[model samples]
Target: MGKGHTSANGGSRTEGYQYDINEKSILGDEWCSMYSTTAPIKFEKSHFETAMMHLIREPNINSTAILRADILREAVFEIEPNGKPKVKEEKTQDLEVTDPEAKKIGIDDLDVRVAPTNPLLNLHVVIQIVRRIIPRNLYKDAIMNQTCLIMNSSSSKPSTSLVVYTPHIKAEDECPFYIPHVKAVGILFHNNVLSVHYIPFDNVELLRDESQRAVRTAWRLLQTAYKHSMGIMEGYEKRVNHDQVVDKVDFQDCYIAFKKRYSKFLVDNWAESTDPKKHVFEDIAIAAFLFELWKKIYGKDFKEKIQFKDLGCGNGALCYILISEGIRGKGIDARRRKSWSIYPPDVQAALKEQVIVPSLLLRPHPEVRKRIPHLEHNGGLFPVKVAHELIAPATIVYSSEDLLQSPQVNVTEFSPDTFIIGNHSDELTCWIPLLGYPFIVIPCCSHNFSGERVRFNVRKSTLQSSSKSLGNSTYAGLVDHVEYIANRVGWKVEKEMLRIPSTRNAAIIGYENPFLDQFPTQEVYDVIIEDGGPDNWIQNTMALMKRNPRSH
Candidate 1:
């Protein structure tokens, strides 16, 4: 049972088991149940208590905190002559932060009177069910109603004990009787030992599973909190904290601006099955981060001097946002997304549909070059099964001398300060670093030079050294490999766990190297050529290509 959210059974025991009603009912109206569990044995009392406090303050610790769970608002507790606790008007910050003495309070240990701005708003059950079943319109209406009541609810008259208010289904509400209107969960810390207990009203047979889940979740949260306090939770921390690598550039302002200006349009026009909030939020964050990065590198006058090429830019929303921000950039992908049309004509012009092939591959095929005089500037290896007209319907190969004059062959040539952006660039993830320029690769699908989905064995040094090996998941391994490759190629690499909406958020960054003169283009070329090069890579890319009929 939770305080201000207790079971109907009137359970008020702290140390031993207590059952006020023993009769069992199908809906569980008569049985009273209390559950207790111990905390991790390794954690010292002080450390565990502090961790627990932190968990309450930051329930988003493991993304497990119930979205509606009551945040401690204001409360007062006083023990009456009889054992009942009396509540008085009290105001303060979250108890998790203000009340260190609260650690001594256990289940049914102290009666508290609370004035929460969010009484029912903190109910975990309400949050879970409403999110699943209620329509957005109804949910908004209910929230507005709750907000009005919360604002009007006076703190002048506090309840007796912390177990004051419980959620009961009213005529309009659909709460089950088995569920206690008000319940309280308590944690006790004494002499380096910890105990957790739940006080439910009459323990209904139906609530056994729910009660057990609550206990298990609490136990897990305790362990997580303990691990977080000790700084040993390498895996757990990564998921909770989004911005891992801090740079001089701050993109928060850019993100704020995007949300203020463009969020409604993006949300209304979202076409994918994935959550629109996350997709749009991620792009905004990317734009903000990139803009700041550009500002930091180019000083105040860094507009046209910096140009970007987004390899495998899906949907082209990011490119649109960047271009709209005054940074000149173009996105190239084997296929164009439908969202491309939604953009204005100017932004549409910045997006191109083309497959990228390393220039080195063209140099080796003399037979293909003889037929195409413009081999140096324009040469394409098409999929064996897919017709060229389907993929590159309007693509025209140009001469190397006219490289600067061609749109399709722009990838083959790079001017100084060209920035390669690889957001989920699948096959292009690994190649971005080898392109010998400043680039940011947010790897999604792992691929080798042959353009096949191949997972690289993450280096022991990189994996073991990383504080964020959340798991040996394939995605994490791929991100590690990309970071490792960037470092291996002598590109002063920097890795950041972006504050993006997606779980696959690691960004491998390469900037201008001070040792560029020592490790020039030839050195980069020698390394790749010696490592079997892109000799067979082009053939594989062409073989896998599937022409998009829609492009035609």
Candidate 2:
């Protein structure tokens, strides 16, 4: 009499007949077929005809099979305590559930709690899978799709855990699809279900060529958004533009000098003069602005005992300005030449005359001349007479080469309150902060452990995800890395948009606050290791400094 019943002779009869049905096959179709030849049929009448006989009989084979099939069906889509289907909704249309409680039920929505947070574990798994899958083109679409799906699931809005995996749609054979930037992936939560919106890959063949590009695009977008939000881009732009101008001027001057020395070579080369004076003038203006910045931050006293070390003291123009201000400064560089001849003879003569005033005057006094012969030859008792007095212990000790790499010098020898200024320290940007001195670094190029060039680490992901290399000599990407590193090391970092000479902008200014307790020496090493492992610049410097503290 049940649903799985039939009569003899194929008659449409139903009373106490039983038949077994395949639950798997039945569920495959939307509608179940009854009395079909595919289903086994059985019947029993005597067992039920006489109630006095007690209808005692053996278990019906057909009935037992039918019961087993029904049990399997129940297991597949068993109702939960809330009276909602427990199975995942595979079809998108099937997701349209009216019950608010049932709406959150979906395939990807199952909550699997993980404890003891480890972010790198997931990334490592993904990376390993990617590396193992040869011919990356084959799985490119899947990987991109997965990225989009995961990114979209992370909702900005508060919601219960619910996931939905959209079925892949058939793609046209000739159509092309490109992945969108990772930063553009938008996540939304509606009715407790997370929705991910991302670009679907059409051609998997381009994966190998496009992988790096896609990652870079994503990172750049993220970085741009962060910089804009933080209002650092405007400042960065000004500094970069100023720096470019300064560089152009120096390049032009060098070119002119070469041409002047070799007229035949210049004619043969047919190189025309490019006037970079305008750029030089602009740089001067930028320098003035920097001076104003220093004044504003430290007041007029900034010119006092405070020593500024131009890490890469090119041309010594800045040093000249500081010297004019009576600041004790020294300029060091790998390349040294006597260009003082460029000054007029009268000026030079005046300097020379003043330098020998003491010697000239003390010549008559044997006692004075013996003590100061150099000065006594020129004049009485005094040496180097000029409009302004020069201060002692150079205000700036900079070099084009790696100053920190030198075995005889340690950073601490500069001064306890020295300001490390990397106007454009190039590769030195990475090691600038490790000196444990107050620093102002303007990043130019990107450099990392593997030595691969990158713009920025746009993703707020793990540090390794952001690791990149130092490209051209002018790129200061390492400075940006140092910014992140300094913060982790507990140095109060500040960024100011300097109105400077180049477009390669953004200056990370850091200071050691006396109020805060000094970070443990070991902690410094820990930070370096944590930030993209160890590198030669960091390891060697630390080792050398440890061995010879006075040499740093």
Model 1 Cα shift for residue 495 (angstroms)? 1.0
On residues 463-506, what C-alpha lDDT tens digit does candidate 2 reach at each position? 33222222222333354466777676666776544444455556
CA shift of 91, model 2, Å: 65
Off by over 4 Å in 1: 1-9, 12-42, 49-59, 62-188, 191-242, 247-253, 271-278, 296-305, 360-407, 467-473, 515-520, 540-552
Per-candidate clash tally: 27, 58
lDDT scores of the candidates, listed in order: 0.51, 0.34
TM-score quality measure for candidate 1: 0.58
lDDT of 1 at 460: 65
Among all windows of ten consecutive residues in candidate 2, which has the lowest summed lDDT?
124-133
